[model samples]
Target chain A: MTISVLVVDDSPIARKMIRKALPADWDISIQEAGDGDEALAIYRSGGIDVIFLDLTMPRMDGFTLLEKLQQDDLNCFVIVVSADVQPGARERAMKLGAIEFVPKPIDPQALREVLREYGVMV
Target chain B: MSELLLNDDQTAALQEIANIGMGQAGNSLARIWGEFVALSVPRIATVAAARLPELIQRCVGDGRVSAARLLFHGAMRGEALVVISAADRRTLGSLMGFPAPAGDGDPGAQLLHIAETLAGACLGGIARQFEATIGFGAPALIGEDLPARAVVRADTLGVDLALCLEVRFRVEARSLAAHLVMLMPRQEVQGLAVLLDRFLCTL
Candidate 1:
């Protein structure tokens, strides 16, 4: 099964970097969103398997989106990818319902391990 | 002194570097100041030195701006200018646990302290990214209600163009805000360009 992934960040370069991190050969369909609102729209549209999120954004942040997902009881596999590596940020994101936290610029090896461990990739 | 030319990738990468630095800076202030900080997307560009006063004025929003300037030296060297609205200055002492200003409690001193921590953390954050070491000079406080351009006089830095990074931080709990900008003169911008290239290769 091809994993459907959404890369959400305000920086085009940052989204591009995240794209480079994913295995080129992996069977994955990728979509991009500039902020939480766009990502939420795509999420509501369905078929999104994993969300790589960024914390600080223009309209609705990752933490807010996470809260919304929780409030709606939306089943989500959110992995926060942020430059804000503060300890509090990580704890807050997790409390709101993110499955994993990856610091920027994305470490491909760690991300791969996360994908494999979660069975998103065989 | 030439136009600081940068391609699209270089420009985007520079902004990301500034964003990463801003994140670390926000984390430091939030941890020590006991407030959540909301960061604006950083504005990165190369601007002519002539337009600086106008640019600085726009960032602070009013001439009665309180500012602290610090010089940072490293493989990459530049100056950091942090300006807080006089309106927001009233909240600083209490936020950092400093007592009421008694009479005219060295507001200058207080502003310098905040700038040192905020700007130092930001530069330190950027250094960690480049795997470089940076040392900061003492913080200097500009007078209250001074023009923002007073922070840098034309004859002082002597460069016709500069690489600039500007970011705003909002204190979520108190609704206070600070405008922070970092600038490197012509020579250092060339160095920064090379560093941006190395960062992109890794990406």
Candidate 2:
């Protein structure tokens, strides 16, 4: 079985980093979204099992995206990859139903652990 | 430094917020470059609106510098900037995988992209500390000679008191360094102080 992942961020560099950090051995199909609008479109189309989201994007931000996901009852696991790592960031993301909060520059080991814990690895 | 604009508690709270924000920014940049980057503990101050220009001058000195700035408004209005020595432009460009400009000309486009991304990330991180909603305009370039005035007048109208936070960045095993400066309006500072006090009460 293949796991579908959506990586969303405005910066090309950041999106690239997140993609690079994914576990090589996993049967994962990756898709990219430069902003929340695009991410939402793809997400609404279904088949996304996990989302790597960034908070401060151009059009739609990660916070709004999280809210939308919850409103529509999307059951995918979300891991927030953001530079806005303030005191309340983790709590806020958790409140929005994110399974993990990883501050950027993305750490591969951390990414791997989160994937494993979430059962994203086959 | 003169009269102590913020008391010890306020200053400490702001510094802690800055530290968290900068640490997140450093981690983001490190991920992009696939390397570790270190960030300094941010130095924060609340200064009278009148003293802003002089304070900026002292920080930059008489060096050839360039800045990328973003103006934000909402619960509080202010700007965030990343300033770097002009000579370091090439190094930054190289680090980000942008080829050097033809000859020794300006560092355009690519540098602006980096600046905007970092500014949004760092400032957004800081604003979240107070649970304030801040909106940022597009990033604009401000030459060394003009950064102080540009920062002070980021709003559409006249000047206002400001909170300044300066954090330095040093990339691992690289000769590049940059300063991230955030200027928050006085009203925002007061609101943040109230929020911090309330936060302490909860603690």
iRMSD, per candidate, in listed order:
1.5, 13.4
**What TM-score number comes out for model 2?**
0.56
The runs of at least 3 residues in candidate 1 whose Cα sits more than 4 Å from the true structure, single-residue gaps closed, are A23-26, A67-73, A116-119, B1-4
Q: Which digits, one per residue and each the tens of the lDDT, describe model 2 over residues B1-203?
A: 45554677667666655655676776567655554555555677776667775666556554566777778777556777777766666576666766665753457565567677677667666667667767889887766434434443434425456778888766647756677778776656676677667644532
Per-residue alpha-carbon lDDT of candidate 1 for residues B1-203, written as tens digits (9 for 90 to 100): 44646778888887877788888888888876788787788887788888887788888775567888999998779999889887788788877777664854678877898899888878788788788889999999866767677766666768888888899988878878888889898888778778889988986
Candidate 1 chain B worst ten-residue window by lDDT: B97-106
Fnat of candidates, each listed = 0.65, 0.12
Candidates in order, TM-scores: namely 0.89, 0.56
Tens digit of lDDT per residue, candidate 1, span A13-108? Answer: 899889999988899899999988998889989888899999988788888989888886767588899988777889999999888899886899
lDDT against the true structure, each candidate: 0.84, 0.71
Give the lowest summed-lDDT range of ten residues in model 2 chain A: A82-91
